[model samples]
Target: MLKTILSISGKPGLFRLVSHGKNMLIVESLTDKKRVPAYAKDKVISLGDIAIYTNETEVPLHEVLTSVKNKENGAKITVPSNTNELRTYFAEVLPDFDRERVYPSDIKKLLTWYNILIGADITDFTPEEEPATEETTAETETNAEEKTE
Candidate 1:
């Protein structure tokens, strides 16, 4: 089921819920005023608040109650990652390439593509063979003269 959060205080008030899909919640505050909380999208439900949703986290009102209960009773709670945060995480892991070299402009995928595209071979690293030595130049000159003779 989709996760949610709800909060309940001593007084009657509304709470907010934000999820990728609709979920059910039961909030009964047994405090002094017996505040019956309602579901809200943004702020509190009774206040007609809108909720925020994405791949990362959901600040749903109903889940607020669950969150508070967990805190009071020592239950476990896990916060979801935000979509933007995850994207940024991936971006940081991606290699930093010369901007001029990448074509399509997708930094993330381009990093992976580059690793597969080109590779070095043993021949490409043949030990620094000394430059054309003076002896080699003289041998070539002598060969040319022999042909003329």
Candidate 2:
């Protein structure tokens, strides 16, 4: 669902990918529906591809956003301007998030993005499960054979 949503650096809000051109992409603003051509020089990052740093590993942005949504009961959260408050809020959502790697600004951006997504009625953040690998499929077949024997 978030595949077409893009966060272009230097742009104020999110954009939905419309179509691709030879050296650029045609995008429409999620907020104003203003269609614009994003050049190859623009830094465009998909919301699906973004992740947050955790102590154990990186957690996908969608999961973090989902947690925020669930915690706030689908309401927009007031982004804390104070650094300590921001840290506390992030800790509540992701206790094991790497404090050093995840800065206050990053947290602020996440909260802002979450609010934007929520306002746009794009709350579904559930990612599709990956298909079983060849090795796992083979193991399942072998186990079935043994069970039948």
Candidate 3:
């Protein structure tokens, strides 16, 4: 899901979280399947945490991505190079997207990200449910034992 997908600053494309290292993360590029170490100094952001400014409120990136998917019928879209046309295409996808706050460059990036995601066969934009941790499982067992006592 989006949580495991990362966008490293200065990096060309999105990366999938492969493993954790000391003071760094091992990330696999979504485009090339190449593994690289994203150091702690790098500004690594999960796609799940990103949101787009809207007229009324902020919309999560996943929702926006889903909207784009719906608009494109799950196919890669040709991002318009012209600024005005790009805005028009984005407006069709998100009608209430803030015209003032959302720059054309931002829209272009979103569309490009969508195309990359589609090309990588990453269609699911929803967040996956987090699995229970050891601490939580132990707490649950303790509670059950206390109740039985």
Candidate 4:
């Protein structure tokens, strides 16, 4: 699910991946649903591909967002612009996050993105549900044929 959501550097807001072109990506802004073409030159990073540095290791962005969501009771967060406040909130959300590797700006960006995601009701970061297997499809077809017969 997160794979379809992209964060293009130099862009103001989050964008949803609509399709891929030869040398560009077709993305729709999550905030206003505006469709735009992002060129290969743009630094486009999928939320699924992003992770934060933790004291123990790296933690996926989705996991960190989930932690924030649980902390906020799935409510929209008002991201703090102040560095110290942002750091305090992030600490509550993720205590073991590496302060050195993860800067204040990074925390602010995460907060803003996470809030946008929550506001858009994109909280669930679970993997996409798989399609039915061929065997299952065949069984269903056979059952339908038997009923018709």
Query: How high is the CA lDDT of each candidate model?
Result: 0.32, 0.92, 0.93, 0.91
TM-score of 2: 0.85
Residue runs of model 3 more than 4 Å from their true location after superposition: 131-149
Name the 10 consecutive residues with the lowest summed lDDT in model 1: 117-126
Which of 2 and 4 is ahead in lDDT?
2
lDDT (tens digit, per residue) of candidate 4 on 5-38: 9999899989999998999999999999999999
For model 1, the stretches where C-alpha displacement exceeds 4 angstroms are: 1-44, 47-55, 74-149
- Estimate, for each residue in 24-91, the C-alpha lDDT of model 3 and write its tens digit: 99999989999999999999999999999989999999999999999889999888999999989988
Instruction: Pick the lDDT winner.
Output: 3
Off by over 4 Å in 2: 128-149
- Rank all candidate structures by their TM-score, best first, as comma-separated numbers: 3, 2, 4, 1
Clashing residue pairs in all predictions, respectively, total: 24, 0, 0, 0
lDDT of 1 by residue, 33-136 (tens): 23343433333232112222323443332233333333424332232255444344333333232233333333333222222111111011112345898999
Q: Which should have the higher lDDT, number 3 or number 4?
A: 3
Span of 10 residues, lowest total lDDT, candidate 4: 120-129
Per-candidate TM-scores read 0.18, 0.85, 0.86, 0.84
**TM-score for model 1?**
0.18
Best-to-worst order by lDDT is 3, 2, 4, 1
Instruction: Flag clash pairs in model 2.
Output: none
lDDT of 2: 0.92
Residue 16 of model 1, lDDT score = 27
- Hey, what RMSD does candidate 1 come out at? 27.8
